[model samples]
Target: MLKNNKSDYMNWIILIGVFVLLLEVLFFNRGVIFSLFISAGMIYLGRKKSAKKKGKILFWGGIVFLCASVFNMMTFKFFLLAILLHFFIKYTSSKKNPNRVSPVLVEPEITKQEETVVVSKPLLDNTIFGQQKTPTGVYEWDDVNIQAGIGDTVIDLSYTVFPKGETVIFIRNIIGNIHILVPYDIEVSVHHSVIAGTTTMLDFHQPKIFNKAFHLKTPGYDHAEQKVKIFTSLVVGNLEVGRI
Candidate 1:
């Protein structure tokens, strides 16, 4: 998966380089047209790769903005200001107080009849931009927390071996796509919060709502000895939970 991510990054870099070179050499006088074409191509490829509903909306919206830019229908300065304002708001909302104490987890009480073993590890605060891939084969972890700012994240647990109990995954994403692959034998549950996003879960049928929250779980999840629970918060992105 890491190798695949590197390859995808390299491909995007090459594509951008080629587009810039073409713009300088052949489309200097018609820069807007070139920009429109490239943006449209990106939108098309993105939709083809994920088929995400929110992604489609974002892409189509970009096309509309590009058209306005090309025709000078709106002030370019106002557009730039709006972009800046968006970033400002995002940055402000994500900020945390430095003096605030972090939460600590307490160990559960164990009875004499049963031995308590800690199988999961705590996940530190980590931020990822672009593409990220987890350890591929036979992966084992107690808990996972991820914050993805953009691009793609793939968590492949199909070949993993889970301990006898429950595992937890928490993910927050903005303008990104998260794909989780689990083994068919394992039970799974998902609780999702979406502010303009979408989620597709295996073996769960529910009407999708825009800018809303939903929960999904496989049958027999509550009684399954080995289970996984995923909690996700997404803003303008896609989340897919599937079996291998």
Candidate 2:
């Protein structure tokens, strides 16, 4: 409840700021209103036509007009700085959390039966930045979570084994590219949320957008004995899933 209240308060503050800015633009800088209208029209046309190139053109043009209306470039610079600072602070804070769990590599355990042998692999929870590649070979894991902040991450599970029922992998990325390689035999499903990015699963492609959510699944995902479910959130990045 307290968190909700705080969020409401912040939203109100933002609304008030927008109201004041609107009043100022209408009274003190009427020329800006015209620029805004033009920008809006361009953006609308671009969206209607599904032309990303046109959208980019008008978006930057709108920013230029908005900056001119606001008097100087300092505000824009400050806004960008604030955004960077916010992400930096958020990243550092997450790393510093006392309850945060660190990832560890585990080897498979072997057990012998009367006439057979069995191997049980450990689950993996990895948080990585920059470029990384998953260990290659046959293995089994229960739950895998990956946090890739930047650069590229390649995960190949072509030869791995999954336990019966649902196995989950969670990924959070920012300004990075993730490529997941899965085998054809196992069922795979992906639930992804992207902001200003692209997601490609097999032959399906999701173009970059302001915000988009995608759910992709292979055949037999629902009733398959062995299934892999991947939940991913990406910001300003790309995610590609392919067969091995």
Candidate 3:
């Protein structure tokens, strides 16, 4: 009952606080927005003219104006008051409630039981600077997720058999090329993020891509039971997702 009452009071306090902030922003602090923009412009002009006397004046004037405008706002004053009140309450509560030893603190720690289970490793291992490729022959299928520093990754899905449901492959490389070959029958979804690279996915080709994110999916990807979802992130590299 006490906790519930406290929670209810907290909710009311939050709602009232929000209402007060809205009122301050709409009525009292209406000019703060315009003042902020003017301050920013003044700062920019000041920096551009910093080599001369006018630039320095503009910069210092903008800084002083921004500080004064921000400090004069009711919202800023309220925030400062709230922070001070919170610290005061916390300090008084700590002083009133002295720490006492409890059974939980003095109780002995229990030993945790250990059990070992064998787990198979993924086909693609993370490397710093090297080429990562799936074996040419038949290999057991495992979800591929690896992060590398500088390496080229090539995964041929044609050789391996995918299990039922969606198969996920995530690869993040700092500076490397990624190439994945998918079967024609399998529905594939590719989401790639690259800073600077060339992307070639099926028939769609991007010769030059800089700071771009691409999402491509087959037509029947939504309903397909067996589909591959590939997510690759590269800083400076090339990505190729071709149908075999």
Measured by lDDT, the strongest candidate is 3
Tens-digit lDDT string for candidate 2 (33-69) = 5765565444334333434777657645654664465
Best by TM-score: 3
Per-candidate local distance difference test: 0.69, 0.69, 0.84
Tens-digit per-residue lDDT, 157-194, candidate 3: 98989999999999999766899999999999999998
lDDT tens digits by residue: candidate 1, 103-191: 99988697558668876554334565567777655555647887876567788886566888998899887656678998889999999
TM-score of every model? 0.50, 0.53, 0.55
The window of 10 residues in a row where model 1 has the poorest summed lDDT is 73-82
- Tell me how candidate 1 scores on lDDT: 0.69
> What's the count of clashing pairs in each model shown?
1, 0, 0
Which sections of candidate 3 miss by over 4 Å? 1-116
- How far off is model 3, as Cα RMSD? 12.0
